[model samples]
Target: MPRDTPPAERGQRLAVYSHSDKRVVLHVRTNAITHLPPAASKDFLLLCPHQGVGEDDPAGSCPRGNTCQYVHADLRGAHRTTPHTKRGAVAGFYQTHLPGSRWLVHLPVDGECPPKLAILPSRCVLVTRATPADAQGSLPTACPHFTLRHRCDRGVRCRYVHAVASPPESGIQPGRCLTGGWQNDPYRAVPVLQSPEFDLTEHLPFA
Candidate 1:
């Protein structure tokens, strides 16, 4: 049924952020998040800092311009000038960059869903495993079969280690993995078989 749904329709659903009562509701299928009700005294909505800074102005313009990633007041047609007070500016900056801020959350564009949010194949393990150490005097090289084919016919009975070495971090932030599903099942003791086509690190958010 998910595959049958039109991409445009899915995207439209993801863009809808509704709030009821005080708790937030997360639409896993659409990646839409309903935020908690804002406090009466504080408005959480943040305006973009580069709203009116002209390209040629010495103050410097919004680097992204029309394509700026932030929520700009001018782009939203609010027509409000940037705050001059230090307190107002600081509050706005924190609200805009807060880890859990709603403004930072965005719907996937052009059907390019985050890998962790996307429905990955249930037959694979999403977590990368650390490689096993070599025996006392044995060579540190990995098993040829496991390195070349990701698996060996001998299974646990193999003389050499069959684990895949975790790759070095690329310093790129990975997609967030929501709890639940077979890929995240805690009761399952055995790790799923790794597939050469899918790199485990690429799918894990904390990897």
Candidate 2:
């Protein structure tokens, strides 16, 4: 099991096969993986609903004007008229604000399952997990691009990385000027000692 995998997704290796076209009979959303092969399990590709916008960039634009590129699949067929028309596959999403973009998770294992059109449980929606800063459980680092407005919009949905934000720097404290200056002197009568020895009148050029 990968260190970053969520507890919900951490299941025993129930089966393993080399066939690329084979579909593993299980619904990740329903926790109904009883049909998995009884053989020693190896890494397998779980079909994710978050197929990002296809090559048609404009086709994936959300109707709510939010910048969601991933399609919200209608796994239950809640809004499909024809089998060809994907239920959740609407032209554009009505949400004006989806917190973040969906991540494209490609497992590094060999013989990973390719995308397939199979019905599965709805609860199996894939959510991203926090990246490990190190194996020692050190604090996770945030996505550098996340600070930019474009990246911040993705919030947790980003597949890259996230972290607990540090508190903003406190406003500069009001302090005395180092150069010894005053914006306003309230003491109208500042005492001054007159130097009798140094006469400015005698040193004057006109004198």
Candidate 3:
């Protein structure tokens, strides 16, 4: 009679699959393989209930509205749908103050899942100013055409500078300057330290 191996030695060793990091179990008797499911995490995508169903009711369809906790559907594609929860029908809607800005009333949607918004950090461009001491060196000048009308007639040939804005230093919060005027007002030009000089005739049609 063959001697029985110890209880610990009788069981097959569990191996981990390098690609997926999931544990694989091997049955010694049948030579069968089984993979254990990955652990559940909050990072998983949360599908909206009203998705793929139809257009959400304009009056009110989702009870959570802006307060829905799970991730929302994408807004850019045709498959996108306004998020609506099945808990209770109230209103299905979502809105943001600015493009890429945080949701006004939404919470978890900003921090969790598909429509994650809170992770986006505020950014601004730092325009370098010309000083008398540095007149000898070449420096970038803000494009007046781009600043006033948000377009440059010269395109790439324009001598003016077009600086890309970015987030400020550590501990420094980024915000719009409302000192000169409301930044959102379309009629008024954006506030700036020094306005660039340009010929009025260049922009005039008859000139």
Candidate 4:
């Protein structure tokens, strides 16, 4: 028997380690993500543009530095689906500026293990254990202008919506008509035929 073992170790019960028995691992997070281990490429899907940007850069456009300003992680799927599902694989990790020294990660691994904004062990595995089927299906919403014009000027670069808008059930048309007064203009109006339709030629300026 080990000398450290107390009288309880000699009993039939197995030895157990409590949460305090484990060593607390601390990870030194940085803003520079270029040097980090190669993981999934889900940056474009992230709503928070600041994921790959520097801590001081609010625009999220500056070049990558030596440390990460946002939370970053490698996520897999949990293989479950629910009506509330809204995110995809791990997109990033961010640290809170509060005094509690909190950390957060984005996206879920599978439908079951959805990504949550919670504090986790700093030294925990970077990659989650999930392989989602529709992992790459998280697309941004379509812009309002996209609904009127089928073609979007911003194309894929537009961060706004890219989907179609549902028509209102009230029957009242939404948005101002682009034709405006042109539809009522006499010069631009189509010529009305006699007999077949009410002859409006009398009102024509050339009549």
Candidate 2, which segments miss by more than 4 Å at Cα?
Answer: 1-129, 132-134, 150-159, 163-166, 169-207
lDDT of 4 by residue, 1-207 (tens): 012222323333211111121111111122222333234232221212333211233334424433533323211110111100011101112111223221222211111221222222222212222111235633221233333332233333443332212222232222222242223431121211111111222222121
Candidate 3 on 45-106: residue-level lDDT in tens?
Answer: 23234332222331144466555443233221112111111110111111111233211100
The alpha-carbon RMSD values of the candidates against the true structure, listed in the order shown, are: 20.4, 28.2, 24.9, 27.0
Error of 2 at 99 (Å): 18
lDDT of 2 at 131: 40
Give the poorly placed runs of model 1, Cα more than 4 Å off: 1-136, 166-207
Better of 1 and 2 by lDDT: 1
List, residue by residue over 1-207, the lDDT tens digit for candidate 1: 012222234332321111221111111221221121233222233223443321113113546644543322222111112111212222222111112211111111111122211112212111122122235522222233443343333333334322222233342232333344223432222211221222343442222
Give the candidate number with the greatest lDDT. Answer: 1
Clash pairs, model 3 backbone? 124-165, 124-166, 125-165
Instruction: Give per-model TM-scores.
Output: 0.17, 0.17, 0.17, 0.15
Sorting all predicted structures by lDDT, with the top scorer first, yields 1, 3, 4, 2
Model 4: ten consecutive residues of lowest lDDT: 77-86
